[model samples]
Target: MIELSFAGWFQCRLATDPDPYDEPRGVSGYVHAYAGEPDLDRIVSFQPPPFRRTHGRDIGVAVDAVAHEGIAVPDHPLVGATVDLLDAPKFEGRNGVVADDGLEPLYPFHLQVARDDFRAARAVVPADPSFPYAELFAGGVEFGAAEIRKATGEQDLTATWAARVTALRAELADAAEPLRTAIAERLAFLTGNLGADGGGAARFFGALMRYDYVLSSEPEIDDPHGWLDATDHDEPWRASFWLGGWDADVLCGYARGTLRLPDGAGPRRSPRVPRVTDRRP
Candidate 1:
């Protein structure tokens, strides 16, 4: 279980394929969660961070996870975090290998490739399951390249590396102070990527982190599974606006609330998560 070392963050995506997500009893959104912040600049050195803000778009990969992370397992009682994470992305940019589907990605769902465990996010259960998954609003990017260095194994513990890590930690400490206070004023923290909203045992987030790309999402979510009850196999809904390649950010939107599926793994075989070659952050 790879966890985050920096402050809280979330990664969101849009809901392009609703048949796999929409449901009668409940409909949930997906959010890939990760620790440490991303250096979109260093990662994509040629291209600077987007001057304009973006919300992620819907992803379609087969929707076969959700039960492994010890969360609600969908179709169960709609509780716990309000968002989710999966491993899949269809690139459509000029440089993207996947053809354009005409879906305008609101955020940077560019196709991040970290380790194999790439589907970590928070979810919520709204009063009505049919509603669209809401997107958390964020303020500004609070993490930097140095903070990531501290969190990942990249932190050099050697005399020289230790000095750099020390300096980086100090910088993160100072930077995280205001950010932490800001979150304390509005958000809650949790162990896994499953953040919760402020109400009861369930976790949600007021803000989230965005990733340039994701490694885990739905596989062939549109297909119905026989292992679970028919009632649990409601059509899927939609989730948009999330993630920044592992970095934390302040949220700025809120639409979808939450929903549920069932407690079955189905016959869908899990595929290999995407690998981000030589990621800098």
Candidate 2:
């Protein structure tokens, strides 16, 4: 599953059945793309600590050389875990719960296991009938990252990476247009009333991450490299202007992003918010 620009999601968890790689040093968790959609019957399910030894394929990626998965930009520590789908059967998700392309069910699947009798494991999201968009995104981020790594195999990470980035931005821009336009208006209002600096790009990014991106922010957050990094990786503000620049095939129907609100809150990935399964209700 490929992430849409709808939101920015990062994988932060992996749990092991044995609890072997507990608190391993220096390898602060960040998602890495897998080669193919893993065979769950054979592989372990859920997130794993770096030491939680298991096959990469079992980690829910399609096993192909060109599969390309996107990890967190500034990889953060493991705050979440990949657990047994059986343990998490209630379907608290967004990925495997797919919008069908045709008659085929594009259910978002996770590859946490591989049973010997089963040939096709549930690689996409489970068949949960009612989950919020947030759950689908959460599962798909891990799966999509693996798919991305497979899709992008060694090709130019920069250009190819940029394409996915643009796709995500477009998705987000479309989803967030209401919030974006609203924030722009809010900033304008703040600029008129308070000092212009009060609602500058800093405020924009802060609020953008909050209302538009759904990211949690802190003034004292540390970044050894600041704008220079975002310049290399992060899409520019103008990306919103160019709508159709991303390569279409690269999109895997799964995307990760933030759900920014105009409340002067913070930025967060999809899972942080409340995900109700029965949305249509």
Candidate 3:
């Protein structure tokens, strides 16, 4: 199986046992790409850390050099499929709660790639050209950063972040109009009114990780890497295994108007203020 990566988070089980958390039993397939890397080498899934072991509990799979399966981008919704692994696989063993207890070998686990419905994800699109516009979003992010810098009295660090934002804007200059526009508009909304009630300064940074592109704000949080892909409801976004930098737990409260921004060291602790999940309630 080829190690695959993508823009947003994607995780699924071949088995449809109905329990969302249970591992699928008996299935195998090869992945072609990951995060858009066509020449991926290995596909490995590590079990969660044991109470004693901090790292390196790799589950073995039967993968061929040639990719047998292709994972679509967020544009191509991943359809459920069945695959046959070359060999009986070994799962990283754990003690309890697991349906099989990791004792009964579950090979060829049914794999169904799942993700958040693109409709809500599509909310990031910039529908109106007037409402704070995309440029304003960028400006808001800049302004928020400036405020942080002022608070910390770190003129040099602020200057450095400003330059990084400038370069990011330049890089974004080449992106598709819709993507660029949407990012700008949403970001502006997020960073619009800092220390204000409605502005989503915290939310914008939270959703930042979902983006196909990487942005730099702080020295510790700077990553300028990502791709611009067309939107597709069927495709998987990011791998489920990929952890987010921000706290999603706070997003629901923030969106519901129940949470407040943190005092100092705001961005890191208050990662995402917007809930990616549907808020229809």
Candidate of highest lDDT: 1
Give the lowest summed-lDDT range of ten residues in model 3: 252-261
**Local accuracy of candidate 3 as per-residue lDDT tens digits, 138-205:** 10111233433332233342233344345446656686765566445423322333334743223332
Stretches of candidate 1 off by over 4 Å are: 1-9, 12-37, 41-76, 88-281
| TM-score for candidate 1, residues paired by index | 0.21
How does candidate 1 score on lDDT?
Answer: 0.25
- Per-residue lDDT, model 1, residue 111, is 22
lDDT of each structure? 0.25, 0.24, 0.23
Q: How close is every model to the real structure, measured as TM-score?
A: 0.21, 0.19, 0.18
Report RMSD (Å) for each prediction in the order shown.
19.1, 23.3, 25.0
Per-residue lDDT tens digits of candidate 2, residues 176-279?
55545533433333333233344221221111111111222211112343311222111111001000111211211212221111221234224233232333
TM-score of 3: 0.18
- Candidate order by TM-score, decreasing, is 1, 2, 3
Q: Please count the clashing residue pairs in each candidate, in the order shown.
A: 78, 85, 39
